[model samples]
Target: EDKLSQEEKQSRANHLMEVQEQISYDLNQEKIGKTFKVLIDKKEGGHFVGRTEFDSVEVDNEVLIDASKFYCRVGDFVQVKISEATEFDLYGEVV
Candidate 1:
């Protein structure tokens, strides 16, 4: 088995955390009932944040992603999750 250094291990862990954040964000976005789009705002430390067409600066909801996969880009028109009255968005994994 290969041995990883403490720094290396921490790096891997941070990467994983980022992925989970992106996935969570995507999942939340999927809850939006209306069809809305979002742009990947920026990533800081390990968290990824974004904004949707329907989301206001402080009133509306925003998209948070774990960013696990490399398939998604900033401007991709993905089919997001839908809910009754909330605004959400997401990109379903391709089977």
Candidate 2:
């Protein structure tokens, strides 16, 4: 802690955060317009919250399935065609 100035430490932290954000954005971009198998986790408002096979229940990204297009229950696995993606969430429809 004594080796670096407070400003230096803050700059390093900010840089790391920016790099993490960029990596997440790039990964999400790759999923756009792609399809993946996802497990329905729960319902949020009018959308079904789900996680793809590559996602972790606790930390990985989740996809929001438009509930109006299909009826799904929690814990059900379904294929989703990804339409949009953000750094942390994806929006899609059941395929």
Candidate 3:
């Protein structure tokens, strides 16, 4: 396979970093806008934490299920409600 040039590699890295930063910022803001299918990976005090297939656990985004109204069991593919969203994550309830 052909290797990327230094400039190209840097450019790609920068782009990825920008996307990651955007996602991170969005998650912190809890601005969920779209809906997605998510699995309940684990539970926190008031947060049902999981990751989207498009999102990486540590690098990409997370699916934040509102513990109040979102109904989901671990590994279940349920429709989630996106009340708040961020570039890297979304806060949703089960619909």
lDDT, candidate 2, equals 0.91
TM-score of each candidate?
0.36, 0.88, 0.59
The TM-score measured for candidate 1 stands at: 0.36
Query: Which candidate's lDDT is highest?
Result: 2
Those runs of model 1 whose alpha carbons end farther than 4 Å from true positions after fitting are 1-35, 71-95
Cα lDDT tens digits, model 2, 1-95, are 39999999999999998999889989998999999999999999999999999889879898998888888999999999999988889998898
RMSD of 1: 12.9
Kindly report which residue stretches of model 3 are placed more than 4 angstroms away from their true locations once superposed.
Answer: 1-20, 23-32
* 2 against 3, candidate with superior TM-score: 2
Ten-residue region with minimum lDDT total, candidate 1: 86-95
Q: How many pairs collide in each candidate, listed in order?
A: 15, 0, 8
Write model 1 residue lDDT over 61-85, tens digit each, in one string. 5555555642345555444433322
Q: Per lDDT, what order, best first?
A: 2, 3, 1
lDDT of 1 at 74: 55
What RMSD, rounded to one decimal, does every model reach? 12.9, 1.5, 5.6
